[model samples]
Target: MMSCSNERQIITNAGFLAVVASQATAGFLSAIFSIIVLRKCGNLHVHQNCKILIVSMVMLYIVHSVSITILQTTQLIRYLTYYDPCVVGLSTVICFCLRLPASVCTTSFASLLFAIVFERATALWKRGKYDAYGPQLGYALVTISIIVSLASTFWAVQKVEFDQHSVYCSTATSQTADRVMLLCFLISGVNIITLVGIIALFIFNEFALSRREFDLQSSYQLRENAYVIRIMLPLSIFQAICYAIFSISSGLISLFRDKLSPVQHKTLYTTAY
Candidate 1:
C-alpha cells in the first residue's frame, strides 16, 4: 500500500510537471500571438491608442506567462533534486515573489482594458479631439496602472508564506491580506462594469448607425467604427468575465479556507497560483 508520504510525493511531482507543461505551452503560444499583433498593428494610424493598449496588455500577459513558467521550472528543478516539488528557498521570498508578478500583471491587464473602454467611449462621443490626444491618454493610463498595480502587489505579497514541508504556499488570513483581497475584488467588479458599459455603448453606436441619417463619408466612418467595436466587444467581454470569475472564486476560497479539507485546500492553492 502507498504510504501518505508516497502519495504526497506522487501528487507533488504530478502537479509540478503539469504546471510546467501547461505554463510553457501557454507562454509560447501567447508570445507568438503578441509578436504577431505587435508586428501587424504597430504601424496602423487610426485607432492608434487602441492598438497600443492591446500591445501593452499582451506584453503584460507575456510577462505573467514568463513569471509563472520560471516559477514552475524552479519547482521542477527542486523536485528533481530534492524529491520535493515545492520551491525550497526562504518561505516569504519565494512564495511572495510569485504573487508580485502575478498580481501586478493581472491588475495591470484589467486596468488597461478599462482604459481601452474609456478610450472607445471618448472616441464615440468626441472623435476628433479624442484621436488628437488618445495616444497620450492611453500611455498615461497604462503608466499609472502599472505603478498602482506594483504598489498594491508589493503590499499584498507581504502576507504570503511558502512552507518547505507543504505542497503549496498560502496567504495569511490577516487584515492586510483581507484589505488586498478587497482591492482585488473591487478591481474585478470594475472590470465587469466597464465591459458591460462598453457593450452598451457598442449597441448604441450600432443603433445610431442603422437608424440615423448621414452623408456618404460620415456613414462610412460610422460603419467602420461600428465594425471595430463589434469585433472587439466579444474579446473584451470574454476577458472581463474570466477575470471576474477568477477574482470572485479566489476571494471566496480564501474566506472559507479553514473549512476546506487538506487535499481540497492544497488543490485550490496550487491551481490559484
Candidate 2:
C-alpha cells in the first residue's frame, strides 16, 4: 500500500546502496591485490618497481571508486526527498579527497613509465654506461613527478571553485572547469603519443640487439624489455582514451549546465559517477 513517491524513494535508496556496496567491495579487493603483489615481488628489484606501480594504480582506482559511490549515494538520497545539506557537503568533501590523490598517483605512474622506458633505452643503446646513470635517472624522474603533481594540485585548487548547487562535486567554476578538462584531454593525448614513441624505440632497439654479437643475458634482457613495452603501450593507450572521453564529457556538461533540464542533470551526474 505504498504511495508512488514512497516507491520511487525506495528504488532510489536501493540503487544508491548498491553502488556504495560495490565501491566498497572493489576498494577492498584492490587493497588485497596490492598487498599480495608487494609481498610476492619484494625480493626482485625489477619486480619491486613493478609492484610499486601496481600499488599506485590500485590505490588510485580505489579512490575513484569510493568517490563515485559517495556522489551517487548522495544524489540518490537527495532525489528521494531525504536530502540533507550536510550529507551533500560530506559527499563533496569525499569527492575531493579522492580527486587529489588520484591525480598525484596518475602523475607518479606516468613518471614511472617514463623512467622504465629511459632505462631500457640506456641499457640497449649505451650498455656500458647504463649502470653509471640509471639509478640517478630513476631518482630524478620520481622526484620531478612528485613536484609536478603537487604543483598541479595547487593550481587546480586555486583556479576551481566547487559548485554547491550542482549535483556533481568538483572544484572550479563551470567555465574554468571546462578549460581545465580540455587541458587534461590534451595531456592524455600527449601521454598516448609519448608511450607509442617509446614503444617504437623499444622495438627498434630490440631488433638491433638481436642481430648483434651481444651477451646472451643482454639479449634476453632486451627481449624482456620489449615484452614490458608491449604490455605497457596498450595499457597507456587505453588509459588515454578513457581520460579523453571523461574529459570531453565533463567539459560538455560544464559548458551546457544552464541549458540542461533536471532530468538531464541527473542523467549527466549519474553518467559521471
Regions of candidate 1 where Cα sits further than 4 Å from its true position: 1-20, 43-45, 84-90, 128-134, 158-177, 211-221, 259-261
Error of 1 at 95 (Å): 3.7
TM-scores of the models, in the given order? 0.78, 0.70
lDDT string for model 1 (1-273, tens) is 224564355455565457555655676677677677667766654567767777788788778777766666665565556643233332555656664676688778777777777766766676534544546867877788788877776676555444433334334334345767776777778677877887787787787677766555455445556766765678777877776676677777787977975556545655654
Count steric clashes of candidate 1: 0
User: How many clashes would you count in candidate 2?
Assistant: 2
Question: Cα deviation of 273 in candidate 1 (Å)?
Answer: 5.2
Model 1: colliding residue pairs: none
Which runs in model 2 stand beyond 4 Å of their true positions? 1-25, 43-87, 91-98, 129-134, 161-168, 171-176, 266-270
Model 1 compared with the native: what TM-score? 0.78
What lDDT tens digits, residue by residue, belong to model 2 across residues 10-32? 33554444554454456456556
Worst 10 residues of 1 by lDDT: 164-173
